[model samples]
Target: MPKTYYGKYGIEVRTNEHNHKGQKAHVHVYIHGVEVGAFFLDGQLMVGNVKRKDRIAIEQLILSNRDEFQAMWDEFQKSAY
Candidate 1:
């Protein structure tokens, strides 16, 4: 997992590359080492639970840096192979 964004109050956004069979591009949101949510590049939540304020912050972060995050995901996929 690579740390992508660090925000106020210990919030973080990171990308995880699945090194095994059947994995898709996604990001993980964390607050103080605890995962709050996992979301796709398109800002769709895949799993985990997040508070409303945190959810909005995560979505906004993704939206603002969508292209960069997508590119990172692509690079990570290539590297995993």
Candidate 2:
């Protein structure tokens, strides 16, 4: 698992193995331990996890700093897999 900050909010990246039978790759996001949503692992707009209060901020960060977040995710994957 890995975590990052967007202003005062927190975003987490994590995966659950065997969560649903034959589930494809995906990542989950939580806001201060609240399950916001899960996204397909492809890192595309087809998947999004933005809450009402933080949606705009999260979207901007995700779009603007994708590389940094992706790098963090890569390291987490290395540790997990």
Candidate 3:
């Protein structure tokens, strides 16, 4: 998994590329080591629980780092082969 940490939040791109059926580009979000949910590159939560404020913050963070995160996700997909 490729991961990036920001303060108390950890965002990761999981390596299970074959499991992404109908799913868009996303990252799994962890807060304080607990899995919160998976979020699309656009900052929409796919599944799991996240407080509104935290979700907003995460959205901003994702938007700010969208390019880098997207690149990591793309690389992970390629590595599935």
Candidate 4:
């Protein structure tokens, strides 16, 4: 899974990577080693095992990492849109 620069909250920055199949191109976020949730490059909710606060934080993280996430998708999919 390719990782990406998500966001920074104080000293904490949300980061994620691509995982699984049967799903669209997206990233899974984690703090330390625990799985929080997932979100699509189109900015949709896809969190697997996260809380509401984490979901909110993930949204903010998405805005900041949107480009990186998109870049990852473009590179991974290798398709033009």
Q: Which candidate tops lDDT?
A: 3
Candidate 3 at 21: error in angstroms? 6.0
Off by over 4 Å in 4: 5-23, 79-81
Question: What is candidate 2's lDDT per residue for 1-81, written digit by digit as tens?
Answer: 456665565556553332443344444555666767655444443345565657655555566666665665555555533
Model 1 TM-score is 0.73
Clashing pairs for model 2 are: none
lDDT ranking from best to worst?
Answer: 3, 1, 4, 2
| TM-score of candidate 3 to 2 decimals | 0.87
CA-only RMSD, every prediction: 3.0, 4.5, 1.8, 6.0
Tens digit per residue, CA lDDT, model 1, 11-79:
233333344424676676777667676887777777888888877777777777778777777666666
Across 1-81, the per-residue lDDT of candidate 3 in tens digits comes to 667899999998776554464457888899988889989999898899999999999999899999988887767766644
Summed backbone clashes in each candidate are 0, 0, 0, 1
lDDT of 2: 0.54
lDDT of 4 by residue, 1-46 (tens): 5444344322122223323333466666676555555677655666
The candidate, 3 or 4, that scores higher on lDDT is: 3
lDDT preference between candidates 2 and 4, better one = 4
Compute the lDDT of residue 74 as modeled in candidate 4.
56
Error of 2 at 43 (Å): 7.5
lDDT of each: 0.65, 0.54, 0.84, 0.56
Greater lDDT among 1 and 2 belongs to: 1
Best by TM-score: 3
